[model samples]
Every structure is written in structure tokens, then in C-alpha cells.
Target: MDVKLTEEEKIKVLNSDDIYGIMQKILLRESKIDQNREHFWVIGLENNHRILFIELISLGTVNKTLAEPMEVFSFALQKRAVKIILCHNHPSGELRPSEGDKDITDKLIQVGIIVNTEVLDHLIISTKSYLSFADTGLLSELKKSTKYIPQYVLEERLKKQATEIANKKKTVEIAKEFKRNGVDNETIALSTGLSIEEVEKLRVRKR
Candidate 1:
């Protein structure tokens, strides 16, 4: 558990223990905040598993913390992260996760799928020890419970889908315009990168 990282260094995370080692240093240095208060943090990771960023999403009282999926994933999206690791501290020094922990993890895993970012693991940390959902196989079990997804995540996913549909419609309209202008199917196909058959179909459909 080495506890040193330079500002420009990107740590490649191999497992849960790597995360726990990094967090250990953070807890040691962050003395301003009460060690007894719970804190929720998210580690953003690139496609290659290199660390992109670490962000503190929420802080709470002794036993509980509020970790919203929207808040968590917003940072991931902003950072262009392809995956994320969730970590939170329990001041009580109990490594066992609460029901709230499982529920939040389940919901975030669902949200992650919708957004194209994977939730690799969730960790519960104490001063002396830590618990890893992935290591214990709890993350696999949690992924099966897709009964609930956060409303915010659902709304954003719908918005993205709608935008994609609108863009495709606009592309079709442009192709139709080219057809109306007497552009040959071959020339239109070159301009729009559509196949000759596709351009012909578009022209026929517009009639």
C-alpha cells in the first residue's frame, strides 16, 4: 500500500487493493474534515484502466452519506471516463456495507449501463480496513437487480436517444434535397458517403 502520487502521474489500477492504497493517503492528509464524517468519492478511469480523475461527490454525518447517481456520473461524463470506481468511508470502522450501500450501488450500476460507462466496483473504507464489492463477488449480484434506475439517468438517456433520431432525420432530409437538385445517385452517394442503392432508395421514397 504505497501512498505517494505525483500530480502528473496516472496510476493504472489493477484491482481493488490499488484503490484502497490510494484512498489511504487521501484520508491521512485530509485532516480538515472530520475523520468521523462519511465521504463519497468517485474514481474516473480511462478505457485502459488508467486513472483520469478522483472526485468527492458528497459528504455526510457519522454513519450515512447521500450519493446520487447523477452527481456521480456527471463527473465521469465530464472527464470522458469510460469506467468508474465508487468509494466511500464509514466512520464507524465497520467494513460491512449497509442496505443503503447496496441500493445505491445497484442503481448506479444500472445508470452506468445507460450512459455507456461501466461501474467496476464499490468500496466501503474504514481507518484500518476496507471492503470491496468486486472482490467479494457482490458487484456481480448487484448487477442482476435492475429493478430501479434513477429518474435523472433515465431522462438523460432518453434525451440522447431523441437527439440521435433527430440527427438521422436531418441527414435524410439533406439527402432528399440533393436528389431534388438533380444530383445523380452516384454523385450524391459520393457527397453523402451513401451507397448507390441507399441513394436510389432515398430518391424513390421521397417521390
Candidate 2:
């Protein structure tokens, strides 16, 4: 007896993998945040076939900073994705959507509509479990009302933004101090994890 495989069957076989497990594995590989890291992730699907799971498209160390759609969608567009599932983890282990999260999700959904891609769901994953915005009917309501922003997301975004801004300021200060102390751009870059261009900018600013 002989066996043959069809093209569609071959494709399905090649793509056969646990989507949730794959996502968890990717998340595990990322740099573990302190008690406060804000992460934005997007999972792409093509005609009900999951293609990719991306993490930290835009991220911050604290709560106040929000992830932008452009950052999130850049990878999706690169992958030519047709549908998306957005997810973020709450370090606090709270599975509730914050105002900023809701606002961003709504904006993303609108953008998805404009770009002909569907925003299938937004999930809030904690250490142990997950909450789906669509499961709670929030997605449908957002499309209809367009006036809701959960407080949690806003707080989270603000925290992240504050942390990121503080880190950037610290980097600039370190670069300036290095320049003032007769440190070369290369040395400063190596010591501070900053680019040579950034160190050059600091040198120019110092002088």
C-alpha cells in the first residue's frame, strides 16, 4: 500500500503545535521584569491558522506607559496577519482590564477595522490564569459604546511611562557624567549599555 498527502494536509501537519504553550514558552524566554514590567503582545492568525506569537513589541518597566498600535502592528503587518489576539500580563496578578488597556484596545480594534484585520480578543493573563475581554463581551460593547476606559490600564500605563522616562533620564545623566569625566563615547556606550550615537549626543549636549 502507498500513502500520499495533499497540500492543505501537509500545511496543517507542519503547523500543528499548541498555540497557548507556544505563547507561554515565548513569554518565558523574555527578560523577567522586576515587580513592575508592562508588556504588550500580539498573536497573529491567518484564516484560523495561528502563524505567530509576539511579545514586548512595546514595553516599559512601570505602569504608566501605554504600548502603541504601530509598534504592535508592525510585526503583524510584516507577517501579513489576518487576525490578532492581544495579550498583556499583570505583574500584580490582577486579571482586570485597566482604563488605559481598554482605551488602547478600543483604538486597536478601530485600527484593525480600518486595516481589514480583525481584533479577535484581548486577554489579561496573570501568573496562573487569564481573562478575555471578548469573553466578558467588552469587545462588542467597545465597538458599540466607545466610551469606556478601565482604570486599571490607565494606572498601568502611567506607571510604565514614569519608569521608562526615569530610566532614560538616568541614562542621559550617566552619559553626561561620563563625558565630563573625559570618558570616550565607546567607553561610555560599553559601560552604560547606550549606543555610540547616544553617547555622542550626550557629548554634544555637555559641550
- Judging by TM-score against the true structure, name the best candidate: 1
Clashes of each: 0, 22
Off by over 4 Å in 1: 1-5, 149-207
The sequence of per-residue lDDT tens digits that candidate 1 reaches over residues 43-157 is 9999999988888888788888899888999989988999999999988888988888999999899889989999999999987789999999999999877468667856887
User: Taking the tens digit of each residue's C-alpha lDDT, what string does model 2 give over 77-131?
Assistant: 8778887778777777787889888888888887786677788878776546677
- Angstrom error of the Cα, residue 17, model 2: value is 14
Measured with C-alpha atoms, the lDDT of residue 13 in candidate 1 is 91
In candidate 1, the residue pairs with backbone N, CA or C atoms under 3 Å apart (3 or more residues apart, or in different chains) clash, namely none
The TM-score between candidate 2 and the true structure equals: 0.56
TM-score of 1: 0.68
lDDT: which candidate is best? 1
